[model samples]
Target: MTTTVPRTANSADTRGWSRWAAALILPIGPAAVAVLRYVLPYDTVDDSATMVSKVVAAPGRMSLVLWLGFIAVLTLVPAAYSVGRVTRQRAPRLTMVALLLLIPGYLSLGWLTAEDQFLWSGAKAGMDAGAITRLADAMHPSAAVAGVFFVLGHVLGTILLGIALWRTRVVARWAALAVIVSQPIHFIAAVIIANHPLDLFGWGLQAVGFAAVGWAILKLPNDKWA
Candidate 1:
């Protein structure tokens, strides 16, 4: 009689490795944001003219920083989904809600990048700062709507995800709490006060929280990860 080998073991091993890869990717978004905040030249208070001037002065550096922000936003989608997946066991409803909001919120970041590109291109073309600022200031209604979605979705969704993580008790309490408060601190720093240091701290908190969760995920056995 010929012996047959089962494929189940190999399939499971593949899935387990995928989970490990995801866990490794989870903290990258927040860490990139932290680094971007540290290196970014303009604050929220800086007008388009000021921003364009900065970009003109250091086009290569500004391009790299903008690309970093773009990468951070893109990676955050998977990171958010992973958080929802891990937390679903204990807080299914909360995870569902958070993902619904967070996914779109993260996606909306692509729209916001258009303005940055416009600024960069204008500077590259040797357009006057005041002219660039004027054009940049003229926002369409759709852009405004997307901006609102990005703000509300990321802020509220992250907080809800933090709550879900807390309920699960998968990660440390401090990690969950850091996730909960990071976004509000970011809003206050970026919008209200326009403080670069505070923005750095906010992103730092997010990085710490995600890093802790990533560590916890790494420790989980393959059977438990799903």
Candidate 2:
């Protein structure tokens, strides 16, 4: 007779790992991306050609950040879900609507990150300079097309979620506001500053926002939140 481990135990282990991942990544992911953007050779919105050129010429740093972003967004999902779960009992409708709005934002961000991989692939493929440049140019329009959804998903979603969390007192009010304000601040700065590095200042603020979310979630008992 063969003795078998219980499925429930294995399932429990998987869930535990997932929770730990969410706890760790929810904070670290956004924080890292915040700093990473400053170090990476990112062109301003006006210089789409330069941005494309840089990616094709040296995709290493940008690729790394994008890959990290991809993973970070995944981790954010469960963490956000936990936030909704914990707050739902207190503010059911708000939590539900917040998640619905925020999830699409995360997905749009994920798509942009995943597209960065294609840049790396093209660079590695030994394409001629003209071919690579052409490809990069071709890819440029996609960002403009997808940006509408990105704004709707992340900016609107975050604002709504932040408001929900604030109203419910699920997280610190200031922290909730930080998350809510991050995207809009970043965009406004980017627009005002235009080509300057300061355009990315919002990333730093976003780090604070995400960190607060992580702290709020982790500080609570797992059974209460998870």
Candidate 3:
């Protein structure tokens, strides 16, 4: 097969950097969000609100510009690079799903923060009074719905991602295989308790899928530069 047809159109490529970024993305992203979240205020959001506001605080507004901007840049550049490289590998379906979830999921900030960004129960919950007042002025009812979609996208996407990680050639393949087998089993458990107080455990299953993908990309073999 011609290099352009599949392997790589340009061995003289930046794919290495792209994969490296993907590997680091999971760990760095949350930390970055945590920092951004810190800058927003926690009061004023009511216990009865149904949406997250983009301007819950100035820091949140700025962080969205920074982190969401980062997300957009990464998606256009690294994600594009990862497309054929990761997707055409031995296991493609799951990897592709993972990527799809990750890229758009970042935008789901609206969904994830709804509980407090616009509806903080108290100052101890999220940001300060000024931020909450700002958010309330701009908050909308759709933010919660947006958040739900975001979480669902991530949750459903994990099944495919877990499969892809299990296929990475990093640790002989047996370890990957073990993870692959275990994910589906655990996934069932998560789905079973998807309601009531047990839903929290379901999240744990999802986190595994997150970690596995991170490891796969981190361990992904990039011989384009070697």
What TM-score fits each model? 0.91, 0.75, 0.45
What is candidate 1's lDDT per residue for 1-226, written digit by digit as tens?
9999877765647657767777787888877777776667677678777887887787776677688778887789999988887899889999999999999988887887677778778888998888888888886777778888888998999999999989999799999999999889989988898887888888789878987887887888777777
Candidate 1 residue 172 Cα shift, in angstroms, is 0.7
- Cα lDDT of candidate 3 equals 0.45
Candidates ranked by TM-score, best first? 1, 2, 3
**Residue pairs with backbone atoms closer than 3 Å in model 1 (clashes):** none
Model 2 residue 41 distance off true place after TM-score fit, in angstroms: 2.2
Q: Write the per-residue lDDT of candidate 3 for residues 69-112, one digit (tens) a residue.
A: 35433432343224325444666666666667755655565455
Report every candidate's CA lDDT. 0.83, 0.64, 0.45
Task: Give the candidates in order of lDDT, highest first.
Answer: 1, 2, 3
Residues 1-226, candidate 2: write the lDDT tens digits. Answer: 9999767744554545555555566665556556555545554464545655677667677767676676667665665676666568877887788788767666666667655666667667765656755665676666655666666766676677777778878667787888778767766655555533443456566567666666666666656644
Give the winner by lDDT: 1
- Per-model RMSD to reference: 2.0, 4.4, 9.3
TM-score of 2: 0.75
What lDDT, from 0 to 1, does candidate 2 have? 0.64
